[model samples]
Target: MKFLAILILLLNILSAQNNIGIDSLQNNTGIKNNLSELRTELDDIFNDPNFSNAFWGVSIQSLKTGETFYKLNPDKLFKPASLIKLFTSSNALLLLGSRYQYRTEFFIDGNISNGILNGNLFIIGSGDPTIMIEDTFEHWLDSLNHKGIFSIKGNIIIDDRNFRQDKYGAGWLAEYMEDWFAPTTGAFCLNKNAIEIKIEPTKIHQSAQISFNTEFIENYEVINHVITSTKNSAVEVKINRIGNNIIDLIGKIPVTTEPYSVYIPVNNASQYFLNSFYEFLLDEGVEITGNAVKLDEYDKNYDFNNTIPLFTHKSEQLTKIVSEINKKSDNLLAEQLLKTIGFEIYGYGSTSNGIKAVKELKQGMGINPNNFIMADGSGLSSYNLLTPKQVVNLLAYMYRSSEFDSFYKSLAIAGYDGTLLDRMKGTKAENNFRGKSSFLENTRGLAGYIKSADGEPLALALIVNNFLVPSQLANYIQDKVCNRLANFTRN
Candidate 1:
């Protein structure tokens, strides 16, 4: 019995030493698997006929052990598309805390006696982009009506002083300026600065019915030329903007099909907000004699200091807003948040200042700022370029920081919600992957965190450019790679 006990102790010591040896090997070499296997797998994926001419960049590292598991052209720059929102969002969380909220204040210059003797309504916006036409505007009107003020003899002045007059992002395509995904950015945005147009088919061979979601239908002249077709027929629809206020809709809709709706960005977002608010006030029984005007149109001598406070509309918390920006890939909200960072940190809200702030933040986070170029916050511009190393570095930094919880939770979970709702469903990566996905004409990217099979956390960034294959193919490759990472275990 004594001999057996001694033998068991010796075996236990040997097992402990073996485990330490394995850990020491991993720590010294940074990974347990042979680098050749990973390289060959990546080469096989990239060397496929579909990506014969594509440029690829990938970087993966274990968060727990700080081991670089794989790297392929990690330093090569590629268009990041919406993946750049990661920078904007993480930086926003670091600079502006998660509890930050945007405030829009209402100030009146004159007195209110017997619901009369009112003055110009000055609305000073702090770049709140979440204001919707349906609920937010109605709430503002209700606030006014609740205050016992129904009439405004003076004008409605919109003070978007928080941001510059530049509404469009730099390098944005002129053709896509009116697209819903590329709506204008401003201190005050309503309905995402877009209008919803619903088209329904009537009887077969009859003209299709057209309708607008907003009461400000007079804002645009619709020239509809649509014909209803038989069931199961191909439905083709096209909307073209001929002039500032003229929109031509030409299409063929099937009678059996449900109503189709499309959202288009307006020409001028500020004016659109004013028009929508004017209509909302009319509906709420509030009378305003003067026209809704921008702050620049008012006299320079108007005293803003004497303005009395009515009510302020506070936007949702920054955490929720950042989730919308990341999960939905909202361009306008990302741009606005970028500018807001600049305005909050510095005194001016401009893209240049915002980019400068982002660079400084990146530098502070130990990332080499010179490796990446951020022309626009939302990555809508083709000029935006980032190396996979830079993205992975950022993700790793965020993963280890105190703000990690907020930043990580804001990302799109695979097969769960956000932009990744329909992707990687029922797979090993379904709940194990959470990241940001990006797509442009010829660019695709995915970057964020993943959990390995042994429950080790990992940060990864994969970017592909100039691929002749469909973007879905790139997504499939990424999903497969993530699955491999999800099943990875240290031997």
Candidate 2:
């Protein structure tokens, strides 16, 4: 009788934990799962005109029990764009620490005789790109005019060695160079390495003249053929290279009281900087007779002299840069961070090093680098490609990281900040959704963490590629699918 009772008790215990039998079968072991049903719904959603031109991938993993909730073409690679910055910022903080600061040094090469330096001037750059963007050239000028140096008796030298000179990305789009998307290089980028081009109304026709707050660093002739338009639209005046040092500005001017000048890299950057400083000194009651010169090393003659120090310039905080890039989706900031990482890891500011670091970081997470092709930190490049599965995998791996808080803190919040500020409104996904947004013509992507109504924590990545439809339609489709996921009542 006791033996009979033991057998019955064991059977009862097995039946109690049905997850091993009925539960497993229901979750695709015992039977087909809701996941399969969700996929069908997703397909219907994708076929809608709102999503017809879209090439998309979505991977969702349940955080509660480590199960995949839904998936569609998760392995297909598509451009991730600025979403790639998640890798750059995360790895940078991981390997380089959270408080790493790029250094810029002021080294004297000549003796200062009665506040007059008789030696060459050198400004060494260590990849601190954000300098003096707060106002204009005047602030930068004042920062360097300290110690009462009336004149620089030598050439103005710039040590760009902090990052090796590699002009641009290897396969970067040709037309991208003309866009402000093409960033200015060098160890030190003053004012995002761009100058302001303003077009304000004048009392006379063709009387408009070019102007910048900073003194001219290089003498380049510029011709403005911009016709003033009667409309109040904002029109940009184009600047083109004529020969070597000459730039021609031509375009239509809108009837507005604003100034516009495209800030471009000065030709022969070293000499241009010297001339600019020289002009500033002249304005500030200082005279500089020496020309700009480039040399191999620090001038040994003036290193030992007790030269008076000029004013110092401070860099924008790393937190601020991250806020701009990760939270605000600033491509320029992403580009700058990539350059800074390249300089730190490979001794150069090219995208190659940044790409390599991201690849390596993915490998560390046990992922294949081929799953995604990273062209730049900012998704502005048409060349960047990432699979939906890869994005989900990255999000999952990052979620498990010890530094996950920082990573999450960097993402744009839904209906609150970043690219999703206007998305998921008036829905359960609102405020509950934290994700990154990507957009181009027919391309759209959203990936991040979420919680279903069933109280299940979930991680998801929804990517759309080749989207040719209107943005509103695409957004509507996304909203519908996301609503489905957010409303799930079970794991």
Candidate 3:
């Protein structure tokens, strides 16, 4: 018995030298057989010149049987970038359930008679992040249509007094508001409260046709320097908005495409939406005497207070949003959803509230929330620190939840959609893996559970950090870990 034990120990040491993550799988009776191919694949991967200097880690577990198939340097903490959305969304589902909705309303303070508003009309916003331009306008127009009124006798009002309008997530990039990063709002925002500029090629003008679909504030100056006509078939478009509201276009306009639209960031979402609603009213033959203004305090009493129910603007379900934001790594939607999670659970507003909600949800999930330090709900913060072990441990616990289907489906499938859409293809890992990947300059991480070729389960969390190599090499190491796991066969 001693000699047999010595032989087993020798084999274990040899496997250890291979640096294969088969330590847990080795003793499993359900594993197909003693394996060496996983080690060989890992060796080839680690030895690759592409990953020579990068830091990376992986921890994989099987959902089929709830066993860790393999792991490599999985305990290391690394920036999760957008993977933090997983925690945010999971907490949202668990705390709020799936069917919750955000609403944008149209309220009135005056009487409606003779098809005209006798008082001020208000569009009350409780910070509905999903309120898009077309949708908001449509609701405004529809509200008028509902009243059988095309004109208003009074001013238009935008009540943006749900949360504090000045609140913006701290630690966010300065460029956050310059792009579709979305504005933090207390009242209302449409199409993320941005403007759209469309350029069309002209046949006779010294410049291309410049058009604006959204409210063009005086702060923005449009320079029509684009030159395009019938002869010059190629057209170029460049936006030179150099740190202010001015958008300078200096290029040719394409003739093949119809005038297109894009949502660019606006200065103040609450005010922007407020101004646009009036513009909509003017177009519909509504004339108001008073200027648009925000209420000092939210009106406690309104016409709708006693009115019967009418459908308000609703957002997409949390599950759908989670699938898009997590699997596809959508930055804006994920951030908004995270903020929404905060607003819903904490009885307050802002991303900080969302961060607090995340911590609480982690505790509720039986995870020591202290083990992870997430500064933001979207994982966009470099300060976000997470260990692969903690993530995998969460996955293991979630595997037994009643909402497992909703949670697992939220992950990106390798070789399919989401951030993993283009990865893990043409191998055993193809369509057999689902996970999230996160990276910053010097940090790298991959988390989620994996399934074996024979359909056994594996839960893995891997992170590599403090490396000086390019992140691409870290990603290369990440792919290597996946490749190694794909070769696993159950005994």
| Predicted model with the maximum lDDT | 1
Tens digits of per-residue lDDT, candidate 2, 245-285, equal: 56667777665556656765543333444455556557667
Compared to the true structure, candidate 2 yields what TM-score?
0.77
Q: How large an RMSD does model 2 have? A: 13.9
Which ten-residue region of model 2 has the weakest summed lDDT?
24-33
Q: Native-vs-model 3 lDDT?
A: 0.64
TM-score for every candidate vs. truth? 0.90, 0.77, 0.79
User: How does model 2 fare in lDDT?
Assistant: 0.64
For candidate 1, lDDT tens digit of each residue in 155-245?
8888876787465688877777557888777777888777898999999999999898887754678888888999989889887877667
Error of 3 at 459 (Å): 3.3
List candidate 2 segments past 4 Å from native: 1-40, 50-54, 133-151, 203-210, 213-222, 231-251, 254-278, 296-314, 454-456
Tens digit of lDDT per residue, candidate 3, span 162-253?
Answer: 54454245556555555554444444656655577777666644577777776545367777787764554555666666766676777765
Candidates in order: C-alpha RMSD to true structure: 12.1, 13.9, 9.6
Q: Arrange candidates, best lDDT first.
A: 1, 2, 3
Top candidate (TM-score): 1
